[model samples]
Target: MTNEFVLEAITREFPESVLLSSEPYGMLTVEIKKDDIKKVIHYLKDSSLEINFLTDICGIHYPEHPAQEIGVVYHLHNMMTNFRIRLKAFMTREDTEIDSLTDLYAGANWMERETFDFYGIKFKGHPDLRPILNMEDLGYHPMLKEYKLEDGTRTDKNDAMFGR
Candidate 1:
C-alpha cells in the first residue's frame, strides 16, 4: 500500500507509541517510544499490512542530544508490495537497554549483537548478546563520537603531507 495508508494504520493502532512521523527519501519513517518498539514492530509484521521482512537493525549515537543520545533503527520491508518503513527508538545514554526483537525475527540475533558491539546498546531479552566484531575486552564502543579521530601521541606521521 501507499506510505500514508501504512502510517495511518500504525498511528491508529499505537497512537501513544508513535512520537513523530516523517518521509525522508520517500520512505516512511516513524519515531516510536523506546519501550514500545517491540510491540509496534510485532503489529507491523503480523497485521494486514504484512510488513514481514526485517531488513536491518542498527544503532546510532548522537552525543549532542543528552536525553536521546542512543538510538536503534529498524528497517522493515513488505517484499510482496515492495514497500518499506523505518522505525526508530531513542533512549538516554545511562539507560541503553531495549527489548530484543529476536522473538519476532530470528535473524535479529546477529544484528542485535552487532549493534551492542558497536554502540553499546543492550538488548534486554537477547539470548547471547556479545561482541560480534570487536574483542570482548575492548572496553568501549568505538562507533561513539566521544572518541578522538586521531591518536595525538603518534609522531611518525606527517600531517603536512595530508594538508592537516
Candidate 2:
C-alpha cells in the first residue's frame, strides 16, 4: 500500500514500458509509452495490486515539447488499501492515438470523449468517439497551447473599463 510498493511493482513488471517514475506529493506517478498504456493498466487493474477504480482520465498539453506535445493522465484507486497511482502516456501531435479503456472501465467512455473533445486525442477502439462537450464544428482542440489567450479584436467597450 506504500508508494514504494506500488512503484516497485509496476517497474518490476513493466521494466521497459516505464519511461519515468516519480513520487510527487507522496503519490506514485509513472510515465510510460503510449502504446503500452492499455497493457499496463490492464495489469494494474487485474493483478495483485488491485488498483480497481479508475478515478479519472484526463489530457495534458505541452506545446514546447514537440516530441511529447500531448499527454493522457490516468488516475487509479485501490479501494481495499486506499492507495492511488497516476499513469501518464504522451505522444506527438502527428500521432495522437491511444487505446481506449472503455473495455476495461465503462466510465472511461465519457472521460475519453471529454479528453478528445478538448485535446484532440483519438481513443482507438472506442465504440463511439466524438465530441462530448464542444460542438462538432469547433474544428480544433481548445486546450492546445497554440491559441491566443484573449480576443485581440474586442474594442466595443472603453479601454479603461476593460483595463486595456
The TM-score obtained by model 1 is 0.95
Error of 2 at 34 (Å): 0.8
Best by TM-score: 1
Per-model tally of clashing residue pairs:
0, 0
Candidate 1 per-residue C-alpha lDDT over 1-164 given as tens digits, one digit per residue, 9 for 90 to 100: 99999989998999999999999999999999999999999999999999999999999989999999999999999999999999999999999999999999999999999999999999998999999999999999989999788898999988898998
Q: How high is the CA lDDT of each candidate model? A: 0.96, 0.94
- The residue-level lDDT of candidate 1 at 147 comes to 78
Model 1 residue 70 lDDT? 97
Candidate 1 segments exceeding 4 Å error: 155-164
RMSD of 1: 1.3
Point out where model 2 deviates above 4 Å: 155-164
